[model samples]
Target chain A: MSITPEERLNVAMTINGRRYRAGVEARKTLADFIREDAQLPGTKLGCEHGVCGSCTVLLDDLPARSCLTLAVQAEGRQIRTVESLADGQELNTLQRAFREQHGLQCGFCTAGFLMTATALLEENPAPTREDIVETVSGSLCRCTGYETIVAAIEQAAADGAEGNDDAKDGAQ
Target chain B: MKPPKFSYVAPTTLDDALKHLASDPDAKVLSGGQSLMPLLAMRLAAPSILVDLQHVPNLSDIEDRGDHIRIGARVTHREIERSALLADRLPILSAAASHIAHPQIRSRGTFGGSTAHADPSGEWPTILLALSATMQAVGPHGNRTIEADDFFVGPFTSTLRDDEILTHVSIPTTRTAWSFQEAAVKKGDYGLALIAATGTPRGGVLVDPRVTVGAAVGSVTRLVAVERILTDEPLTDELAEEAAVAAAESVKPISDIHGSSDYRRKLVASLVRRAVVELKNGA
Candidate 1:
């Protein structure tokens, strides 16, 4: 179906294992749709552009910049946000590691970092310190610098975060 | 920043997508949306329609065509980075793909989209130019192939017409020593200067060397003078120095907030020299 420039399109996406339906304008980004329409504010919008990784989410289990992805483009796709990293009330291994490692200060960039690290650990359950640094280098954090963030991801990998059935089932 | 208003369509067939593009002059083809998304967010581009290629079939394959590898337009950088076939046949492309942005950006950015974007600082364009890859494009008229050297016109510019969609890129499988070097303030940022060099290592001497530099000039350029100096010659410290000087002297770099023209020229020289030394050690 061709959506006109000024017309709103009906788009549906499953975010954090819940389906959300919204009639959004073609210009609305997936990030805004998640926060405003879907009522999922766990995803942050740091740089509306792709430079900052604040709007990163798992599009079909692959990390993508939600701010750059239009809501209409994500129709009928699976989206995993930071909210998917927990098991109901308990924080997952990655999130717990971030808290234990003091990986956040201002906490604005924590959501993006959590989502990015969650995807990384799932792909490479045992990533080296260098691999962790390389993967998280695109994300910027002015609060806790980067050492703590890298340590948190490394800790999560060491703790076998990928094998956590609770987090995995939560994502489903 | 939100994207400006635009109509959108996700055509499942290439023919349908091409027909939509042919019908509207102000329509933009959305590939991976890595580069175009930012432009739309900034309102730098407000196209009337966006022809999304996500559902388009047969545009995301990596095939071995006997003598060469044909990568589809929708192939993502992350896919290239993890492809076993590319690692076996063309490892240089894999190595260069790892240097683009970060894991998140690479996950969604497409190889064809990067080439179509034609940013001077883009790694795919420089690597394709070095390998002399062929770009396959399908337009309203018909299908055609373009040489990598002729594909790029300037920064963020290519010979691809608005009504055309890049379908695939074919790189000939050749055994050659190669090295890719770039200098950036941080990893994933645009490089101050980029260099990709390849040559046939015969005995202890190099032959048919191709040296391509990017991000320093208005467009990706091959340093023929430097290639001429290195061809059929044994690589040494003195030869590397000469090639470096020739590379730095050959191009007119553009000055920007990232770096000065003189600084980029120096970066080109250093990167060229390093690549030469690495190639000499049998890269």
Candidate 2:
């Protein structure tokens, strides 16, 4: 009996406004591809399974767990990571709010929260407190009990209400 | 954990996908991959080939037929939750869709995938059973449709053949008053016991009752005894309580870490009563 060879797929995707191409094994996850092939380590993989949202990234402007997504699946798709939020040197509104409010503790789950919040605020610039809580519910942050994080997102949304909602373009 | 090494194939047509599945008996269907991917990475399911259906046409469409809704296989749960047609036509299912795993899972999990996965505790299977939906599957041999009752076999098992792929589900027009209730540990966890009633108001009573409860033992079961009691009696608190007791006694629930068998029975009783009362008030 002969073992059939596993096929390697060619994956090309745009991440954080940069295009990168690679030939990945069929089993390679998008999280590994972004952190290794694309050399972007902002996306963290807390759980390879979909239960945890620490590896969340915007796949085509929607939050998806990169750990659960195959690299080949990202072909021709646009992905936004935590690196896309800042403009050269300026921290985005959500990041500023997080820092000002001490939304993060260990900062391990901050990227996922930020990305999920960015998607939420981009679609809903004036979200209520309940809406903000639901938006960030997917990502888990053991520290701070999500009180400060939810407040940060709410404040960011409120601040963006004054015509600084520039996170919309970052999502695209 | 990472997914085991496997060959990948993205087929744009249903025929191509079936051909691959027919050729490789160990090939697994990948739609949305919210559930399947997790299983794969957990090493619970390791297929030699993954047939990605992302490029398959017409699989993601939700068509509004006059009397039925032809939901394509790739329609995401989020789409169903946000669908205005479902909200207006199949309100029970729309309300039930909210109980599925959180927004991220809903964003990627597909209606067909969830139905095919056939978790005994799944909201989709329980809701589809309540609607008496039909499963549409196609293989290299041909196409076949299975009723929801015959589709689910056991925990994480379905009637689908390895060579077959579930294409779409046809949900018959639901113009009836309905109610859905469940008890889950968390907002998105599988329910310990789920109950849904689908019937119509006739002569000041909700008639033609079809009450189904899920996460009982293996598959969703219909509380025929409770349905009978509800049909023969007029709508009242006493009748509802009687039917609830009957529902709790009829089921054979199993003990799991999340709930005990006796606890599940009590849940069935309370949920059945709550659902009956809710439907009665609306009816």
Sort candidate 1 into its docking category.
Answer: high
lDDT of each: 0.89, 0.84
RMSD, each candidate, Å? 1.5, 2.5
Across B1-283, the per-residue lDDT of candidate 2 in tens digits comes to 9998887888888998888888776888988898889888999998888888988898988888988999998999889988998888888878988888777778788999999998888888887887788999998789999998899878888999999999999987743778899788877777888888877678877667788888866787778898898784567888889989998888889898888899988999999999888877877
- Go through the candidates in order and give the clash count of each: 0, 0
Question: Per-residue CA lDDT of candidate 2, range A58-157, in tens?
Answer: 8887788888888888889888888888767888788899999899999889998888888787778888898787677778888889999998888888
- Give model 2's DockQ, 2 decimals: 0.47
- In model 2, what are the clashing residue pairs, if there are any? none
* lDDT winner: 1
lDDT of 2 at B121: 87
State the displacement of the C-alpha of residue B138, model 1, in Å, after optimal TM-score superposition.
Answer: 0.6
* Candidate 1 collision pairs: none
